[model samples]
Target: MATPATTAATSAVSVRLDALIAQRLAARALVLAASRKVAADSSGIKTSRFRGRGVDYVESRAYQPGDDIRSMDWRVTARTGRPHTKVFQEERERSVLFVLDHNPSMQFGTRVRFKSVQAARAAALIAWSAVRGGDRVGAVGFGGGVTGEVRPAGGPRGALRCLRSFVEWDALARATQTASPLSEALERTRRLARPGSLVIVATDGFCADAAAQAPLTRLATHCDIKVLMLTDALELAAPPRGRYTFAIGGERRRFEFGDGAHDGAWVEAFRRRRATFVDAARKLGIAVLPVDTRDELARSLALLGLALAARRGAA
Candidate 1:
């Protein structure tokens, strides 16, 4: 049984909209590297153009030996009776929209903070990064049969408005009993996100069925999609065999785990569900980042930033 002080502490760290908002400055610093590529691209372009990398058309020129034959300018080549290739420039100012899930499943966490809080922190970091990078920032926060959307806009004002929505929607998530399908929220996002935008989804992988995946696939057709799966250690593996009591909705519930078989099954189920969602997302050409609740949100997001930078470098 947990002592009163321990219970109070747990409750305190559950989810606080104000606390999340207060950490914005620290979060901004942590994700600085993640958006550096976007900032660089927005400022200027490199002399070398990479073909088949979703760049904007620049001009047509005589084909070079090393140029991709597939990019040959058919009309230009026909008119000049010589091979020509298309040149493209990297785009400036990509839009970044966050799709945050604040459902009941994300409201539970046994460690430092609830998954919902971590998701909000991650969203804030990304929002600030987009602002610094000169990309438009926006978000759709959904759960408990409600959805809050912030239109994409540039600079700090846009970032702050998105952060405010995160806080409000997270609070509503805790109080409502109705479940919001992840697919519906994703469809809404797909409708709002423009082509060439980057969509980041922060969720607990709940309700990730074919319906949910369909919208993401549609969104990916014209936008860069990334999924941040938030999870806790307990979800990955069960605790040691023992009887434990948990406080749920102000009521104490006792659960006994004397045998490891049941616990193993539970862990396996979780693993399978996560694997399914990850595999599906990858198939759709979406990047997946798993954020554990035990890890500090700042460090995890920084690492994610580094990964994004590497991906851009490769591109």
Candidate 2:
């Protein structure tokens, strides 16, 4: 038998809570712009004729063996009697790749909505913002069998599709069957993107594989990887001593949740699976974004932006 209070709490935290989060996202604060245009620059500075990047003409040194022929300063080569290449730096187009985890466990969240819902929203915001910033935005959504696959679409329509695909994705998650491994999917993502591309990975960071560290390291080596490590606040926290038993549609189960701080022999055990996920993030140099559905999106976005900027500086 279960106490009325426990049952009430469980009932409140059921799947229906997701509806509330969706509603919050729908009722965005204000002035939500889905499109953006690049502004003309007139600082007496022009795109490099050779590189098309914002590279000022620095003095050219003798061309090294690996120097690109395309960058060869023909005039300098003729006068200096030695091959020399112009150097240019990129001041433009930021390509961003967003990876989403549509895993079964993500389908569950104890608070407002599922972590999947939050993950989708975060991905959508980043995708839209990237496109808005004149950066190409692409997404690879998987979990219930690779729901949406769009590769760095450019323009307002592309951003809209990113949002729409997220909203339209089937809510069902497949916990069964031979699902794709994160490693293979990561490899595929690497193939689609080039170095210096921003890769945002959204996942609970849990896989059945015994060795999760290796693949993540490999992923980091190829791209500027940022991890949106998703988890519920409560799940990450060790709850007060308690127990739960429940029945749903017929099947019944029980769980013990607590921190054994109540007595010397009692052991406090919150899943703490998120700790392992965080470890993987640190090991792989991933930028972790802890998402709470109850938190405001604007605030979260600001936090993410600052975090990203710092990460970029460090990188």
Candidate 3:
């Protein structure tokens, strides 16, 4: 696979993601989920969304028609005469609130758009599905802490407001002019998230302490927390490091390009750090999605949604 540097650097970004509009990709399915919000309107169809998008394992029971054997609990099957398998559900329709971090760092992107743009696009898609599924959508914009909350509501109007707040993530952060705080973000999630909801958080992965993850667990007590880690393509694939100099927080530093002996060494180092961050989140049972640019959003979401749905179905 080509890294960001070797691929799509010059791809036309002419298609402006109207941060205001949801791109209607998978609109029909998204709408259908909304239609069956209450009264147990099971589409009789499982999400196909199995990759841990949302799930809670129920005990194994005797296998039945249409049940996928992949989820068979071998131990239970051995003990029971009839073939028994596990069951799982997609948690169900509820409000989804996006906690978007638009600190100064998120505004910088090595490619087509800033991390904030990617965050907005993903959030818009979620809001679209929530609207289509007849669930209320809400947004919490923050830089150093909770900046604003657009209370959850239903319908296209609710989705519009949600998208509007997502677009404002950058504007609000810039207005505050403060660096984001990790621990405080956790606290805010704890305070604001409600029971039985989806909480999607978008942030640059410069966290202070791993212990700050406690709030995520706490929020999980009431809601599902899926993390979107926004990073730059340049950060992922180190370019041929031509001479580069920059000032950071008043300190000026100059760095040299690869001296032949250490070609791509820094690139390896970055990949390790990125992988570590992802692994840590996985250990905590929080599903993490990495976003480097807006265009990648569609492919990623479709893949993720289908995977999660399949899991739900199999279970």
Candidate 4:
């Protein structure tokens, strides 16, 4: 169980680095449980089905005429009285790169936690999962017209580096005035992610426009790309039909939704924007997970694991 201080730390708009690190054990537990479920549900399917060229050997089968001679299994061929060729699954040490967006828009939330904090927690969970699965982990955080990168490395070191950078970048984003386009960050990711790498982008839906889609589509060609769109409840649905006043950045703003027409328009606009983003991602063959501010991070990630398991089983 998390302490009040830990919960408060995690729930804050500017998350504490320690809170992110402390969630490692919980993240590991969630990942382990999810992996077991996937294995049990998939039966013969391998849990790590994300394609790669790793050193793990799967099996050997009778050699075909076109089989590579170098992959010949002399021992198996002799014992079976037939030409056999060794078959190895792609390497499991895949690189997991996180592209995190800490722009000003991510600072809002009306539920359990801020969108920015949720993004950080999600990124942390992913890093921990990748490290436990024997994959390299790294991150690229962009906000306030600046981008910070942590090169991919094996073990827990890379995950820790990414968490630290995330904490620092979140603070910088709040204080800095300049704005950086999410497309620029996607372009940077295109250069950083190698073929067969798993790229996870955690951001608000601000960058899901035409300009950003091109870079993401190109990156998805060779890399296994996933997008986690962090959103608050208010963004998805309008509040009760009533006038509301709020304070933003030390200024007061008023909104009128008492009128049915106004309320409907607000809801429709939000739905349209969300639909566009989802449709674009679908067209490019990318999987987009909607991470709501009200949901538990661990539970949400476990659901993602199951979705991936189902996809792999189908494949």
Candidate 5:
């Protein structure tokens, strides 16, 4: 039988509006980069080596083999008697989209908080950070047979709007009894997000299986992608050597862990799922952070900041 103390602790950590709102304080200290916009012809930020026509001329560079003929710096080429190409910088306006998964599976957690709640917390921090970084923030919250979207807008107002949507959509997920696949949300994201935007996905790996890969890959081709894979310790490994029992739907069920009979398969299933997600992310040059439910909010944010920093360095 579960103790009242344990139940109370879980209740306290359930998805709450106040808890997410408080993340505003941590947002100021986030180390995420100030995003750079990309024009229609470009596939990434202006900082990338991508060439395109833009509103402002940055410089003229020696013409490379693959340099676009349309960008030839005729004046520079004539003055220096050498082939040159114009490098133009795009105007600054960035969009950061958060794809939050609140499926029924995410509502389960044996730790301090549900995976859904943890996802909400992480999304809140990132959205707030995006606003602080002067990027327009938006979100697509899907689950519970409901899909909600808030378009990208700059400043605190946009972040606040996303927070409200998070709370409302999460409530719907908790109230409903259906599960929505991660692919559905990603498909919606594809339609909603523009090229060169940054897309952050927060979810438990339950619904992130093979079916979700196509849209993910397509989305990554055009935008910067970051993933927050929320997990519980129980999902990573079998419990200590013992027999644990629980009640489900008025029936008590027993589960044995640490026994060699099934522990390997149990652990391997999770490992395989995680590997698939990692493999896909890596193939698309995306950054991924596996966040444990046991981790503090600050730790998760710090890890995310570090991941983004490393990605920026690589770029």
Candidate 6:
């Protein structure tokens, strides 16, 4: 018989498409407003800093000194018998790309959900938020020898598409051994992301080694990048003093857990893995947010500041 904790853990090992889709409602709380640095063009809801010579005409105003002569509204000027210039807003739909990692390392969690599930939830919420903000949603998934890509697209269609892809990719993760490296995924993302796009990477940082640095640096130059560092309570702190048993490759092993030299080393290993990833991201001007498996989805989103305070460099 399975204990309640064991049952809960089993239930959360993977995510369902409906659960991801349901996040649309919760995503409304997310604030993805545009900042001055973000670009905009045609077919976008977020107002762009640029005005003249773009799609979505705002209105015609009386001609002013130094106004672009090319923007003169001949029809309005002819009707009003006064020189007028057409005002337009560049409404380019910004792209938000999610790079999700589902390596075997993320498959373990001692809390409400696996690290992989938490990552999926975070990505889903962000994707829906992006769509609500009138931005395009795209994704790249790597791990378990499976690679999935969804092209950038806008509105519910795009959000739903990405959600479906998440489910498919996650299923693959649960069934296969992880083979793709995080560096490879980042390189692929570098190619997919356009200038002025925002890329959100969801991973446990297990495979984010030195090899991934170059790709992240290049991507940071043109794209705004955010890292969701998926973590669990077990990984963040030392376990309670006790004897822990583990089964590896069909063999059983036991180890003593306590505030000993080895215990400190174990904790430090997890810290180093997290610090290395976070430090590199910060150095490149990328924002890093830690998401825990034990957190509720809404609370997690808030903590991540999916409100994106980082847009103003406040994070």
TM-scores for all candidates? 0.75, 0.64, 0.67, 0.78, 0.76, 0.76
What tens-digit string does per-residue lDDT give for candidate 5 at 68-153? 89789999999999999998765355688999888777877777778888888888888777677567889998777668899999
Off by over 4 Å in 4: 1-11, 42-89, 246-252, 306-315
On TM-score, the leading prediction is 4
Off by over 4 Å in 3: 1-17, 22-92, 144-146, 260-265, 268-279, 307-315
> Which is superior by lDDT, 2 or 6?
6
| Local distance difference test values of all predictions, in order | 0.76, 0.59, 0.64, 0.78, 0.76, 0.79
Least accurate 10 contiguous residues by lDDT in model 1? 45-54
- Which window of 10 residues has the lowest lDDT sum in candidate 3? 8-17
- lDDT digits (tens) for residues 1-315 of candidate 6: 989876555558887776788787778755533322232322344432666444478999999999988789999999999999989764467788999997888888888888888898889888887777678899999988668899999999999899888888888888996656778999999888876678999998887777888998988876878888899998877789999898876799997888688688878999887777788899987878788998776666674443443332321
Off by over 4 Å in 6: 1-11, 31-48, 51-91, 303-315
Ranking by lDDT: 6, 4, 5, 1, 3, 2
Best prediction by lDDT: 6
- Reference-based TM-score, model 2: 0.64
lDDT by residue (194-311, candidate 3, tens digit) is: 6657788877665434666676667766676788888777676656758777677779887677675454775676566456446656876888877777455655665444433332
The lDDT, on a scale of 0 to 1, for candidate 3 is: 0.64
Cα RMSD for predicted model 1: 6.1
Error of 5 at 239 (Å): 1.5
Clashes of each: 0, 4, 15, 4, 0, 5
Angstrom error at residue 155, model 1: 1.2
How many clashes does the backbone of model 1 have?
A: 0
Ranked by lDDT, the better of candidates 1 and 2 is 1
Clashes of 4: 4
**True-structure RMSD, every candidate:** 6.1, 8.6, 10.4, 7.2, 7.9, 9.2
